[model samples]
Target: MKDSFAQLDLTTEGFRLLFEATWIQRPAGLTATATAGEWRAVRTPDELAAWALAWSDGDEDEAALFRPELLADPATTVVAGHDPDGRVLGGAVLSESGTVTGVSNLFAAGDTDPAQVWSGCLGLIASDRPVVGYESGDDLTAALAAGFQETGPLRVWLDA
Candidate 1:
């Protein structure tokens, strides 16, 4: 089944924050304003290693996999969100173009608001394409909230 989803646009203030950031001091190598999660300037191999460790969650000694030069590149984009306790719950990285090239976690498909927010942000960069993606579940209310139309007659199936 196919459904259309709502697109959200940032408020003027949010747009300002999204577009006008200069620098973010990150624990992992320094990132440009375009990149969301980068915290500091990564100048050395040690710094790059530390930054990689800080960004990852589990026991994966994969920091060495990173190219040191990429850590400081401004063209890279990172985005992150924190829980109430200030721990990261979600994040992603994108090239200058808005593509879901990498994601930390799959989106909570039921949460239309967050999905709308993402679409809104995407609208800013990729205006030609439909900013929203597809989501599937038993819950149609969530889809409605995201501006989706019910594709067929609602039916409930039960085990006999």
Candidate 2:
């Protein structure tokens, strides 16, 4: 079954402060067994494909987030995580309220920290709206660390 997920929501401006105040100051080792990484917006189909491929192991549901219909939307914004070697690590997506960062994001895969991923992903999203998404564990921690307070828990049942 799918695990129950927690939603992390906050204003873009609020999150940016977290990014600038805490997240960006952290170290980024992502090379030669380093402890840093980087993120960039996925502007092309190939870029989106690479990002999605890294996150979609065998789950069609996960891959469906990369559908062309989703990608074609101007609101859609996918960000890629890569190590110094340029290997595709993972990705995050933002889109919903035309000005918020709420859609989808798979920020784990490589050695990058969830906070860093969240911070970087926000770089491309519109800053005028609020951000929201379902996350857990380190990702959840990252969101909270970014200054988001819990509204409530989100139960998500998986097909077993």
Candidate 3:
């Protein structure tokens, strides 16, 4: 489970610390230029399925995580970056809350830079509210380079 505030001590409950990440935020109204790939919101179920496939690297079980019902959510948007040949190179899911948009499920494929995906996602969102998310490792580096600032720490635990 996600311990967003890093306040949970799950060890006694039989959970183990899986990983730690940082909360990241980008200021509101920041503009990003389009990158090499074309970015747009996925509108159809077919498109969403395709995006999920790309995101999971063709792993059907993993792709199933993103259901078609997500597309109907008013606050949720699935954005995909496509190359000239129409292949999905990267994507992200944007969910808007009260004052900030949450960016998640960000992924990049062959020859696609994670920074470019973040930029394209920001351009597609184009919202006045700040963007917030969490990341670790290389993704954290990419988000930082794409103009996000570290906000706080977060942790994930697994029932072991």
Candidate 4:
């Protein structure tokens, strides 16, 4: 389970901390740097499948996590960034809530600057509401560079 606020203690319940990350938030109307790739929403199942492949780096087992039903949800948008030749280079999943848009599953191809992916994603979303997400290590750095601020700590737990 995900402890978004890092306020829960579950050790006694047989849950162990799996990992920790920082919650990031980008205020409304902030612009990210432009990237050479183009970003667009995944409107079709085929596009979402392709995006899943790219996001999972061709790992079929991992790709199966993103079901096609997500596309039918008006509040969820699967975005893909492609190169000039139409090769999906990066992507993200945006889930809109009442007051904020949550970004998740952000990924990029080999050697691609994550900042580019974040920039392209922000451009494609173009939402007036704030964008929120979580990350660790290099990804967190990239998000920070893309105008996101560290809001708080988060933790993931695994049942033992």
Q: Estimate each model's TM-score.
A: 0.31, 0.63, 0.94, 0.93
Span of 10 residues, lowest total lDDT, candidate 4: 29-38
Task: Please write out the lDDT profile of model 2 over residues 63-105, one tens digit for every residue.
Answer: 6677766667776667776788887666677666644457365
For model 2, name the residue pairs that clash: 1-158, 2-158, 28-35, 28-36, 29-34, 29-35, 29-36, 30-36
Off by over 4 Å in 1: 1-57, 63-68, 97-160
Better of 1 and 4 by lDDT: 4
Which stretches of candidate 2 lie above 4 Å from their native place? 1-38, 57-65, 158-160
lDDT of 4 by residue, 1-160 (tens): 9998999999999999999999999999886677878788999888988999999999988999988999999999999888999999898999989988999999987677898899999987665789999999999999999999999999999999
Order the candidates by lDDT, highest first: 3, 4, 2, 1
Q: Score candidate 3 by lDDT.
A: 0.91
* Candidate with maximal lDDT: 3
Judging by TM-score, tell me the better candidate of 1 and 2: 2
> Which structure is stronger by lDDT: 2 or 3?
3
lDDT of 1 by residue, 100-138 (tens): 222221232212234433332232333332222223352
| C-alpha lDDT score of every prediction, in listed order | 0.34, 0.56, 0.91, 0.91
State the displacement of the C-alpha of residue 31, model 3, in Å, after optimal TM-score superposition: 1.1
lDDT by residue for model 3 (35-107), tens: 8788999999999999999999899999999999999999999999999999998999999898889999999
RMSD of each: 16.5, 11.0, 1.3, 1.4
Better structure of 1 and 3 per lDDT = 3
Model 4 stretches with alpha carbons more than 4 Å out = none
| Count of clashing pairs, candidate 4 | 0
